[model samples]
Target: KKRGVQTGLIRTLESALVWVFEQFPGTEAALNDLLTQESGPESLLIGKGSEAEMARALG
Candidate 1:
């Protein structure tokens, strides 16, 4: 994939991660808000649980 597409996919997944986290219980909104604080090729660096959840969400 092109670097741009890779970056976009990463950002989308990361945004999804942040949204999922916010939908959960007891997370610092302020900190979770920081999830997408920057823009570019970055993901949440999430755990397996979140990764699975994200996969399901995407599917």
Candidate 2:
């Protein structure tokens, strides 16, 4: 990063968004709104869906 800000990989979703809120307070509302507006049902489906073969195929 140009500013040397640390970056991380999002390997899993569990607690990841909560960690983001911890790192950047007061962003919860805006972030939630953005994700809601941007994500289609399929995207959210995959995110919350099982990782089994059938689930991935559905996504």
TM-score of each model, in listed order: 0.33, 0.34
Candidate 2: residue 16 lDDT (0-100): 86
User: Can you write out model 1's per-residue Cα lDDT over 1-59, one digit (the tens) per residue?
Assistant: 44456547888988987786668644545344545467311544535347656444333
Compared with the true structure, all predictions reach lDDT values of 0.54, 0.54
Query: Candidate 2 — what's its lDDT?
Result: 0.54
lDDT of 2 by residue, 20-43 (tens): 677766557654553466564456
The ten-residue window of minimal lDDT in model 1 covers: 39-48
